[model samples]
Target: MADLASLQSGPLRDLPYRVAWRARGVHAGAHRGTSSGAGGLFRDLATLLEAPDPRRLDLRASLRDPFEQLYVRRFERSTAITIYALIDVSASMGFVGNMRKLEVAAAICAALSFSARRIGDRFGVIGCDREIVPELHLPAARARAGAVVAALRTFRPTRRGAGGLVDAAAQIAGRRKLVLLISDFQIAADELAAVFEALAAHDTVPIQLIDSAEAASLPRFGLLPLADLETGRRRLVVLRPSLHAAWQRERAEHEALLASLAARYARPPFRIVDRLDWDRLAAHLMEARG
Candidate 1:
């Protein structure tokens, strides 16, 4: 895992994102909004009486009117939206493999913060374990990336569960937001489902952190020592060919379940293995239809 200084020095790329729904915020920004305003994508022509903006009068439309009613062009306004990184900071996130899960998560938040600010959008972070970590809470604002990076540097995943995600969902109830739900997703199926249900109103993107060393790159036969990060239980087992295959199968099943659940209420889960690939992440964000 890279230290804070190294992480800061790394180049942060702008993450391209899009939303299927129209934004409702009044602030001028990049995303398409429901409001009709002075400059944006042309929506439709309305009678001058309805739009009341003579400056946008359409001469051709007015000439074609039977009643000779004046017409004005209406455009869809671009409005600002809040982007949040809803991170799962459970004990399992502390696991170190080919790459540190928590470190990758922090890098993601920092990139998002930078991207959002660059595009005139508000960015925030909400970290959860057994409960919401107050120190990791950042309200939606056009804040600097340094602030986000600094805050994440202090976060330590010591708690056990991610139940606080549901609570954090409730806190961001009012407006539709772009939520990047980052986690290894080592949680009960029912709990994960519930969290998705709570955040259904928002455009949620589930980013599943993965480390191949955890299961994929295991030796075919060896004495394997494993410890449950959440439960603090240690076990030693003989890793046979059959057991290895079974382990991979179980992991695949779990991923399948998560994908099915995400498809129901959000976009398909984006898997980040080993480390964060900026270009791949940008492509996913751009192409994801949520």
Candidate 2:
């Protein structure tokens, strides 16, 4: 913990070490407490988001490292925008929480922030569930990213409060900037058209995290216990064939609703990412550079 506190407060020398921390989800808390888990590499990475806006690269610097600024000076145009990381920390997110979804989503956002920085776009962090956790604020500085990631890794979701996605979209600034909503997306967030219409004026993308059980529709043999990770509520529910079929039906409907929203909010040229392959999340990460 002492080392965790110190390293995040430094720069240059701490880069490699911090990267390891964030990559491995190392720090303090359920999602990040240091353990010999498989997520250690990303734990280190979760900690690397501590750069304060590479201040050396200003508008005049053409959003490049100083050397690159000199080479591409003429081609640089000003369309600087902002990218907001709108994450849901609702308890359902942690129902089976092992930090994989939360960790991956944070890494994706960190990666997005890195790419945004390259294009002269600013990054801001927002963690919400039924309500806003960290009041929305800009994190243009590199150092702020670690804080953002740290907060995210510790964010928890609940069962009762369901947030309004459209309302969250209105909290951001910059039309050029994109709002990324990352979640497991289990609950019905209302009518698809209404949700997309609310954010029609802005650029928004919803990233869903589906666990293996959810993907394969694991059998619910005998009496199964379902615990609400958010509310700490538990119930022994009987799983029947008909119930499983109904669940599958609802999941399909949920996906269709998501597709409809994406279709409505996007144009051919700037089409939103509609049901990206969870199995190939890495590919999406590499290709989603805007």
**TM-score list, all predictions:** 0.91, 0.60
lDDT of each: 0.85, 0.50
Off by over 4 Å in 2: 1-78, 97-99, 135-144, 191-195, 214-216, 230-232, 267-290
Worst 10 residues of 2 by lDDT: 14-23
Q: Given candidate 1, what's the lDDT at residue 59? A: 100
Q: What does candidate 2 score in Cα RMSD to the true structure?
A: 15.3
**Which one wins on TM-score?**
1
Candidate 1, residue 206: Cα displacement in angstroms equals 1.1
* Tens-place lDDT digits, model 1, residues 123-206: 989889979988888888997756656666666677788899999999999889999999999887788888999999999999
Residue 174 displacement in candidate 1 (angstroms): 1.9
Write the residue-wise lDDT of candidate 2 on 1-290 in tens digits: 11223223333121100011111222222122224333223222111123233322235434344543321111111234455766666666664322256655566565666555544445777776666665333444433375677666565555444364445666664344455667666655463355466656555666766555435654755687876665677898888888888888888888777776776673212211222233354343323322
The CA root-mean-square deviation of candidate 1, after full C-alpha superposition on the true structure, stands at 2.3
